[model samples]
Target chain A: MYAIDIKDIKKIYKGGVEALKGISLQVKKGDFYALLGPNGAGKSTLIGIISSLVNKTSGKISVFGYDLESQLEQAKAKIGLVPQEFNFNQFEPPLQILVNQAGYYGIKRQEALIRAEKYLKQLDLWGKRDQPSRELSGGMKRRLMIARALMHEPCLLILDEPTAGVDIEVRRTMWAFLTELNKQGVTIILTTHYLEEAEMLCRNIGIIDKGCLVENTSMKSLLARLETETFIFDVDPPTHLPSSEFFSIKQVDEVTLEIELDKNQSLNKVFAELSAQGVRVNSMRNKANRLEELFIGLVEKGSKNV
Target chain B: MFNHNYFIALKSIWRKEINRFLRIWVQTLVPPVITMSLYFVIFGNLIGARIGEMNGFDYMSFIVPGLIMMSVITNSYSNVASSFFSAKFQRNVEELLVAPVPNYVIILGYIGGGVTRGLMVGFMVTCVSLFFVDLQIFNIFVLILSVICTSILFSIGGLLNAIFAKTFDDISIIPTFVLTPLTYLGGVFYSINLLPDFWQAVSHFNPVFYMINAFRYGFLGIADVSLIWSFSVIIAFIVALYTLVAVLLSKGIGIRS
Candidate 1:
């Protein structure tokens, strides 16, 4: 059975805004999956339905083979959701928040306490466990949310924009922790604006645009679809031209030249051609981040089709 | 899993609600006590000294039951109204909404919080009355029943109000416009016998009068209304309000998106 199964879901809001238009999704057990979409793509709405925080207009959802309609509590028991916004009581202490969330899953006080301390210490929140959450900094508060969501040690964890705003150091630390959790056989479904994070962490990927699933495939297959990449090269002789063997070159300025290289060609071929032409190469870099360019192209393409 | 987690979830929600009020005792606990103290001084002592007797009992002893019931009613309603609405406004209600707890369990836990506050305030006010009058009980069972049932009824009322409230002003509207007026006209300050015949008929329409008079009968062994009728009215309101709250919660009407 799939870790999460969403079949033909539809959500029409009160004012007749159809946020989700018959979307279907499936995630295999123990898979690190990424759901990629731009703003207003129904990612959070889907997560809300799975967590029972938002009611769906029409759909069938199951977690670990337990039907959400008939076995809601049991389905909820298997899933943990870290939402896009901070939703914990600000007056609650971090330790109390974790333990309280554990209680909702039927973990007894002693066991809950142990689990609370374990996650707090693991997430580096143990030192300030007694302080009210209002006093914690932004990064610490985000980490506290993670600890609370993991209190029950759910089999399926869903994170919606979990690292939306944080310093790179803190974000990297969270990525490492999430990676460790996934390694322990917990299925994770993540939605993020950072395309590189998805490229780094997820094995399977799905891209949604305007309530439709535009692409669903393995990470390697998605990345493999790029036919050509543009590279920027700086040359020592500003006005010198390199021999064009297989690349289409455009001079950006006296020192810079743009070249589109096909995936089948190696960088060595360009260097060889430049050497034969006596063009001195100074430095080279990609014109854009690979995944970001791909993501933008995909979203724009999907929108045009609509 | 729901059955297994029900009590645990209820316990967690109940503890959290209790902690919220206790953490702000200056606002939740002390105000009711001070308000009740002033009522005892102005209405029970100084005013009663001039009005001699009411319904064959000393004026001070006569009004004590209404004052206590008033405190219980107000505290019970306010506790649930403020706590639940604040949860909604802050988005912390998602904690419970996303959990495995059943809808009825969520309602029960919140009701427990409201009833606890009502009873605690009622008990404190009763203790405070010891200095103002030599109190006696006609029927302990009826007194306990009236206090508890009224608290439960109003707690359910508060929950309904919270569920429908979109802003802080919405929560205060009913209490200020409807509840306060009803409580004042409920025979707390004077017996319905003092009103003109037509006004007495109108006073009979006020539900608060039945609750206060039944409680007064329990204290003084005298009431303007039948004890059985009052008990039935309280029970009916409790059942109706609780059923409505349960249905609303299960439907995810206000808390869910």
Candidate 2:
């Protein structure tokens, strides 16, 4: 069964700003889906609709085959949402907040307490369980939010910018935890500005721009669509400028030249051709394709066309 | 499947609200009692001696109920306004938005917190009033009903204020401008009978006047307005405010995207 199915979802705020327009997508069970977009690209809006945080103007959304509009409680029970903000009640201790969230799902206090303890321990928040949320550092608070969402053991977890304000160490730890959870049969949906993090964690990726979905596909296929390979050429002369017809020159400096090479065009061929032009190629490197470059290229290209 | 677990959701919000009030009991619970004691000392005893009796009772006994109502109103309004506004400030209300908790439960939970504080502070103020006079609760049922219902109505009003409040100053503005004036004019110190014809007619427009009179009638079997009129007005306000609050919450007026 599909973990989540959204069709023609639309949302317009009271100010008549349309945040999401006819957006649609699906996530298979156990799929780690990463949603990418620039600021105001409707990434969070889509997550809010599925999580029932924001009302959709028109459309349908179902979780684990339960219609969200008709069976919201069931749909919500199967999904957990970690919002972009550090929005937990700051005065309450971490443990109380977690248990209280479980209670909202109708879990008894005793059962919720047990689950809270387990998740807090799992999230490395057990020791800080008695501390008020405000006193916890930014990363700990984010982890607490993730732990709270997991108290009910939701099948689908929607994390919106979980690592946005988090430090490097905590980000890695959270990613590992979420990765392990996905391995244990939980489907994860995440929105992040860090494309590298998405590429590292998610198997499927969706790119949204200007309140619309521009692309959605497997990670491998998305990476494969980029025709350019980045090449940096270092030459002996500090003030030398090399003009080459074989590459699309991005930046030409005194000592180095950056160019984009098509996948079919070899970097070695360009280096050999430069040698024939009487330029000594000291060191050459083909920068691997990364999600950040691809995202920038796609979003910039999409926005210009719009 | 209709999830009947809204009570569960309410429980979470209620616990958080209760924890907030209780954690700062010195600030939330104690100040009102202290303030009311001073009111009884100055308005009820010292100044009451000069004013003398107007309604077949000592001046001190006449003002006790109004003072109690004042405590209830202020506590109820402040509890919800401050709590809800704090949630907004911290952006923590998003937790409820993402959960299965229906908007109504969120509304009720926050209101419940307000009512709890109002009643607690009112009860404490009542105990303090007894030390200064021979307090007598004439109509027990009406007194309890008026105080509780009025607390609920004002709590809902506070919720509306909190939703529209943009900042901490926004939270204080309503209680300062609207709530305080209406309350002081609500006949806390003097009966509407003392006011002239036009002022008495205008005093009738203050909702707090009806509530305080109804509450006062419960204590001394006397009221500025008819007892039945007072009861009906307070109940009507409760229903009207409850509906308005329900609609605003359902739309996520200020909390959602």
Candidate 3:
């Protein structure tokens, strides 16, 4: 059975805000899935519904074959959610928060203490575990929430924008920790505005837009759909531009050029062409983040369809 | 396994609430003790000295049980109201709602917290009163039962108020307008038999009157209301409030929306 299975979920909030419009999704067991969407695109609402924080207007949902309505305890036991906001008590210390959350899941006091210390040290929060959570820095609080969510060692962990405001270095560290956790066979569903983060960590991607599922596929397959990618080339001053008929090249002054090349087209042919014209390439990279480009394309297409 | 998880959930919530009040002892425990002491000094000593005997007992001892009940009701009501509403306002309630704990367990956990605070404050107030009056218990079981029943009733009332409250203002409105007025008119200060016939009839309608008089009956063997009637009203309110709270939680009313 899938880790998460949502069937025709519809959410019509109070006073007629249709946040989710008959959406269906499935995540296989042990898969690292990314649920991507722009703000107001219903990603958080969908997550809320899955976790039973928000009541749905209509739909069926299940986690690890446990129906949410009929088997709520089993379903809840299988999933852990780190919400977008800091919902923990600010007065409580990180250690207490984790221990309390573990207790909520039936872990005894001694086992909860052990799990709390384990996650606190693993998340680099053991040193400051005694201080009030409000005194912690923003990144520390975010990591604390993750540790608290993981206290029960749920089979499926859902994180909503876990690193939205984190600094680059801290975000990198979080990425490494999350990668290690995923490697240990935890199924994770992550929603993040950072497309590169999704591209790096998530194996499958589901893109939602305007209360509709726009795209859902493997990252490899999704990237494969991109017919053309723009690559920036840094060339020596002696290099001459290739024929405009064969390649779409946009000049970036004396020593640089940008070209939109088809995926089927070979970089070797372009190198041979450049060499024949006395142009030596120094460095080359994509003009835009590949996943970002696809994301924008998908969202724009979805908006147009709307 | 599920039942054990539910039990742990209740324990965790109960511990957290108790910790909260204890951590802020100055706000939760000390203020009530001070306030009740002032009542003892002003009402029991000076005023009672002028009035002398009331209902065949010294005025000081006569009002002691009523004053204790007053503190319990106030503390219990305020504890649950503020705590639950803050959870709603801060949205931390989602933590428990998303857990596998049943709604009844959630209500029971919070009620336990409120009852603890009420009982703690009541006990402290009772200790303070002993300095002003030589107290005697007419019946130990009746006294314990009255105080607990009254505390639980008010705590449940507070929870219901909190569930309906949308803002901080909404939480305080009922206490200030409805609760305080009803409490003061509940005969904590005077026996209803001393009042005029019409007002005495009206006093019988105030639910706090039953709680206070039943509690007073435990102390001085004198009551303005029947113990059976008082116990019945308090238990009925507790049952009705519990049912409502459970229903509200099940429907995902104000908190969920």
Tens digits of per-residue lDDT, candidate 1, B1-257, equal 34656888889888888888888889998999999999999988898899999988889899999999999999899999999999999888888888888888888888899999999989999999999999999999989988888888888889999999999999999899988998989998889999999999998788888899889988989888899988888888888888988889899988988
* Model 3 chain A poorest 10 in a row by lDDT: A238-247
Query: Each candidate's DockQ score against the native complex?
Result: 0.77, 0.59, 0.75
For residues B129-165, what per-residue lDDT tens digits would candidate 3 score against the true structure? 8799889989988999999998888888889999999
DockQ of 2: 0.59
lDDT of 1 by residue, A1-306 (tens): 999999999998899988889889899999999999999998888888899988999989999999999998789889888888888889889999998899888888899999999999999999999999999988898899889999999999999988988789999999999999999999999999988899999999998888888888989888898888999998886446664858898888888888899889899988888778777889999997677777889999987888
| Per-residue error (Å), model 2, residue A92 | 2.2
Instruction: Kindly report, for each predicted structure in the order presented, the TM-score of its chain A compared with the true chain A.
Output: 0.94, 0.90, 0.93
From the highest lDDT down, the ranking of the candidates is 3, 1, 2
Measured over the true interface residues after superposition, the C-alpha RMSD of each candidate is: 1.1, 1.8, 1.0
lDDT of 2 by residue, A1-306 (tens): 799988999889889999987999988999999999999999888888888778889999989999998998789889988889888888899998998888888887899999998999988989999987889998998899899889889999999999988889999999999999999999999999888899999999999998888889999898888777787878776334556777776446677777788878976778777777677778877654377778888899998998
Model 1, TM vs. native? 0.95
* TM-score-better candidate, 1 vs 2: 1
Clash-forming residue pairs, model 3: none
Docking class of 1: medium
Show model 2 residue runs off by greater than 4 Å.
A14-16, A231-261, A264-289, B1-4
For all the candidates, what are their Cα RMSDs to the real structure? 2.0, 3.0, 2.2
Error of 3 at A247 (Å): 2.4
Compose the digit string of candidate 2's lDDT tens values, residues B70-151. Answer: 9999999999999998888887777777678777788889988999999999989988887999999899999999999899
